[model samples]
Target chain A: GAGVSQSPSNKVTEKGKDVELRCDPISGHTALYWYRQSLGQGLEFLIYFQGNSAPDKSGLPSDRFSAERTGGSVSTLTIQRTQQEDSAVYLCASSLDSLPADTQYFGPGTRLTVL
Target chain B: AQSVSQHNHHVILSEAASLELGCNYSYGGTVNLFWYVQYPGQHLQLLLKYFSGDPLVKGIKGFEAEFIKSKFSFNLRKPSVQWSDTAEYFCAVKQALSQGNLIFGKGTKLSVKP
Candidate 1:
C-alpha cells in the first residue's frame, strides 16, 4: 500500500527485556511521529522527526524510550528494559509536514505486550 | 493549556439513527479541527477536517461537522449511521500555538446495532 507500514503487528516480551519496533513511512514524507495508545487513554505523542534533523523527544515518558529516523524515511522505536506498564499499541504516523494544516496518515500499529 | 474534550465517552444507537458527538476545545485562537475514525483493527483514518473557509464541512460516509468559534465547539454529526460505523472516533485540535502538532482527546467509542 501507499500508506505507512509498521513491522511486527504484535509483539510480546518478558518484563525487563528490550524490544525494537520499526516504521516505514509513506514515500517522500518528511515528518514522522511516534505515539503510544494505552488502554482508556488518548494517543500520547512520543517523538517527531523532521527531515533527519534533531528530533523532538519532549513527549517521551521516560529515558528508556528512544526513537530514530534514518535518512528521514524508516524509523525505529526502541524500548529498553521494558516494563509491564509499557505495554500498549505503539503507533507510527507520517505527514508531508507538521504544519498547521497537514494531515497525518497512521499505520495499523504494533501492539506490544510486556509480560 | 490547550486541551480537547469529548463529552460523550461511549454512544450506542440502532442503524439509521441520527448521530452527534460533542467536541470542545479550550484554546481562544484560530485552530484546525479534525475527526479520525479507527475501525476494529485498522489504522486511524481521517473522516473529515476543518481548516478554514467553511464552518460546516462535509466528509465521507455522509458525515458532517460544524465549527462554532463562539463556543469553541466542533461537533460531528451524521444523518444516519450504520453498523459499519461501529468504531472509535477521536477529536483533535491543532491550535495556532500548538507548534503544528495535534492534541487528541480520549476518544468516543460508538457501537451501532444493525
Candidate 2:
C-alpha cells in the first residue's frame, strides 16, 4: 500500500467532454510525474512537479491537458475537451527527489477511453 | 530531447533458456538508464538501473544489464529464464541535468514457456 495509487482504474468519457484523474503518491515523496501510454507506443512524459518549484509542462500535448499537485502529496490530471486520440493509460509516479538517479514508484494507472 | 529504442517487440523462449533484450538510447548529455518490468495484471516495477560505476548492473529476479556507453546501449540479459519471467519489459532514460522525467521505449513482451 506504500506504492502510488490512482483513482478510477478506468475512465470512459465522451469526446469534447472533460475528465479528471487523480493520483496519490507515496508518503513523504517530494516529486511527482505524469505520463501517458498509448497502445503500441512508449510512455510519453506529460508533466512533473518538484516541491514548490514551477512544474515542467513541456510535455503536455495541448492547452487542454492540465495537472496540479496540491500540498505536494496528491495530484490531479484534468483533460478538457478530450479527444479520441487522448485516450490512453495515464500513469503517475513519485520519487523522493527529481534527480535522474532516483528510483520512481509508479501507479497502476487509469485507462481513459474517449468515445 | 532523448529517445529510447527497444528492438524486440515480442520474445518467446522455453524455460532454462538464456534471455537477452536489446535497448538503445540517444541523448546528448549524461543520462540515467533503467529497466522496468510489468507482469500481467500488475504495475511496472524496477528491474535494474545504471547510474555510474560498473557498467554491469545486477537486478532482482536474477536479471542483469550491461551499460555500453560507447554503443549507447543497455541490454538486459539473463543466464537462464523461468516461466515467471514472462512480462513486458521497458527501457527508460532520464537526462542527468534535467528534472526527472523518463523517456520510455516501446515495451517488449516476453513469454517464457515452462
Candidate 3:
C-alpha cells in the first residue's frame, strides 16, 4: 500500500514569509495529524482532523498556525509570518480513525528552513 | 497535561549487545502506548504498541516491550543489536479515545557499532 506522502521535501524561505506544506494520507485513513519537530526536539503536536468534524487545533502554537483537510484525504499546514524559530521538520501522520489505539503512519516530512 | 518521557537521550553499544530504552507516560485514564523509530534519513515508523493485552509485546526486527502499569513504564528491548539498529527512538502516548492527539517524548538516539 502507498504510504503517507508530503510535498516539497525541503523549503527555504525568508523570515516573515508564509509557506504551505501539503500531506496526502493513505487511502481510507480517516484520521490525520500534523506535528512539528524543531532542532533536536521532540514531535510537537500541532493539529488533528477526523472525518468532517472541527479539527483539534489545540496544539497550534499561535494564531499563525492553521491547518485544513480537504475531501477527507489531503491536508495542508500553513505557517504564516514564518519565524526563525519555526524552522524545523513538519511531519504528517495518519491512522485508520481517531481511536486511542490506531497506529499512525508518518510521512517523510517537509523540512522548512526559515532563513 | 499528559506527557511521555524517554529515559536516555542517547545510547551507544557494540554489536550483539542487549539494548533497553525506557519510556514512561503520565495519564491517569486509559491510554495507548507506542514506540517509533527513525533511521537515518528516514521517516518515523512504528516499532510496537501496547493497547490492551498482555503486558509483554513484540514488534518488528526482533524488538519487544514490556508495559508495566504500576510503574507507568513501557521499555523497549532487544536481545542483540546490530549496527543497522542505529536510529532515533520515540515514545508516544495517546489519551484514551482522545481526539487523536499524541504526546511524544524527546527521542532517544541509539548508536550500534558493528
lDDT of 1: 0.91
**DockQ versus reference, model 1:** 0.67
Off by over 4 Å in 3: none
TM-score of 1: 0.96
- Model 1 lDDT, residue A23, Cα: 98
Residues forming the 10-long window of minimal summed lDDT in candidate 3 chain A: A50-59
lDDT of 2 at B2: 71
Judge candidate 3 at residue A98 and give its lDDT: 84
State the DockQ of every prediction: 0.67, 0.88, 0.87
**Highest lDDT, which number?**
2
Better model by TM-score, 2 or 3?
3
Candidate 1's displacement at residue A97, Å, is: 1.4
Ranking by TM-score: 3, 2, 1
- lDDT score, candidate 1, position B86: 98
TM-score of each: 0.96, 0.97, 0.98
True contacts kept of each: 0.61, 0.90, 0.90
TM-score of chain A of each: 0.96, 0.96, 0.96
lDDT of 3 by residue, A10-107 (tens): 99999999999999999999999999999878999998999655467889999999888889989989999999999999999999998888899999
Docking class of 3: high
